[model samples]
Target: MVEDTQQPQAQNGAQPQVKMQILAQFIRDLSFENAVATKGAPQGEVQPEITVQVSLDARKRGADHQYEVMTKFRVTSSNKSDNTTLFLAELDYGGVFHIEGVPEDQLHPFLMIECPRILFPFVRRIISDLTRDGGFPPFNMDPVDFVALYRQELQRRAQSQQTEAAPAADQRLS
Candidate 1:
């Protein structure tokens, strides 16, 4: 007899059980440029300072429990001395997820954190391959801290809203 390892449903009726499933994953957009590396110069001569930026967005997909999560990456490699750009790579990767039974309060974080975690490895492989095939050493990206990123973005938005509302509050005091 096989022992069942499934988690039992919550005894409390108020908490809705959550289920997350990846429906599809795809490269929504990809662009890679190699300026100096393609010229056949020695690898040491093309030392580049690389910078990467990441962003995430999620939206409803017109069906119940369906959502689309998009992760965007902007990577730039530039020469250290003259600041000439060596390469610029941008990728927009997206996944369709089926999120069911989660509370409204927990939905945002689930989409931002869990969905991206599922899709990151594929995105990482793509970046590595693109850079290697572009005639330079493969660029392996470090793992992203999605939770921290999400928190920082939330704090930024809160601060911006407070800044924008300050004048209105001051007017009411006058």
Candidate 2:
């Protein structure tokens, strides 16, 4: 018996077939600090407030069709009333993917959005475990909004470029 390797064509047009495979995934770096342990546990009725920050990066490797995508996560929990930090966890997770048939112009967003979407569950689990082991309740991180995150970063870069270009223009006039 032979496997059906051919993919169905789309209704719109002759779009190239898309193929993506996650070759490897890993925790490139991890750290968790329990501030409560260092400073001594709080007195009574500790209310914890948590904040999470996420960033993404992707780069093409030497091998054809292979790219590396990294997701960085930083989590901090603090006492809501006093702003005292309870715990902090930072993780850098990476995945190597073999992607084919995506047009070059669209590759960056694909890596940033889709690849990290695939890696998010594992990243969440690590944080949950990190918090639990660090003597707090298991911290189930909310799912990251990759599309919004990507858009914000793009906006930030555009704003930064405009600022830099304005400075250069002023220098030329002087």
Candidate 3:
């Protein structure tokens, strides 16, 4: 007699599993600009301050389990003393993903953090390459803390909801 072997389900009768796959990655948009320093400006007088902004967005594809995540980066360099622009770079990189087994309640955080983490290295490389090719030193972006970013976004949303609900509550009380 052959005994059947199968994975046991959780106590709640649901399978506990999570799976994510990247189908493809591509650059949705890329732009680079190099601005000349003011004439007679001390050459390399001071290192320019670089500011980088990052954002993540995700949407469901036509397929049930398929989704697309976009990671965008905007970088700017400027001399604080004179407020002169040095260089600017913007990139919108995207990845197509297939996710399964994640509960609906947890899907948002998973997509925002995990999907972007997978796409960041490629986006970083593109930015570095663009800067170097644009006759400037390669600007490598520091690794982002997606968890922190997600938490901040959650807080922002909570605050906005509270603010919106407060006015409605006030109206009902009046």
Candidate 4:
């Protein structure tokens, strides 16, 4: 005689200790452009009329997180009398990260810092690859300080909020 001791009877119960893990990750966008012809006024000279803007953002989607950190090169070289746009290139590099079982306190940092850090190398490689593919030297972006960047963004938002609230306070006084 054999005694069966196994029992399975749980319905609508707490999740069965799901082992949260990254299943898939990948890039979402990438771009590159060469604008020296517009920048140097037909001359083979590299102009200094360019502005580079880098931005980063992250959001949770489904059981994963997504990040978009873009670097834009806006070239405005003056040829004669007009501020002509010699080259305008915007490279938006992004990634989707599968995250699970992350603690609440660590979730924000995981998305804002760790996720971007992981994606940055790939983004840099793509930029260099694209620049070479676009018939130019490899474009290597400088290493980013995400912690500093995050602090700056928070400060800027706080300042903007203060400015917005100042007017309302003034109106109340009048």
Q: Residue 158 deviation, candidate 1, in Å? A: 0.5
Per-candidate TM equals 0.86, 0.89, 0.88, 0.65
Query: Which residue pairs collide in model 3, if any?
Result: none
Per-residue alpha-carbon lDDT of model 4 for 8-35, expressed as tens digits? 2224443333233444445545444455
Alpha-carbon lDDT of model 1: 0.88
Rank all candidate structures by their TM-score, best first, as comma-separated numbers: 2, 3, 1, 4
Error of 2 at 38 (Å): 1.6
> TM-score: which candidate is best?
2
Candidate 2 per-residue lDDT, tens place, 90-133, comes to 99999999999899999999999999999999999999998899
* Poorly placed runs, candidate 3 (over 4 Å): 1-7, 10-15, 37-44
Model 2: lDDT to the true structure: 0.92
Q: Which rank order by lDDT, best down to worst?
A: 2, 3, 1, 4
- Clashes (backbone N, CA, C under 3 Å), per candidate, total 0, 0, 0, 0
Clashing pairs in 2: none
Model 1 over residues 1-174: C-alpha lDDT tens digits? 975333333444456567888899999999998877565443456568999999999999999999999999998988886677888889999999999988899899999999998898999999999989987788899999999999999999999999999999999999
The prediction achieving the highest lDDT against the true structure is 2
The candidate, 2 or 3, that scores higher on TM-score is 2
What is the TM-score (0 to 1) of candidate 1? Answer: 0.86
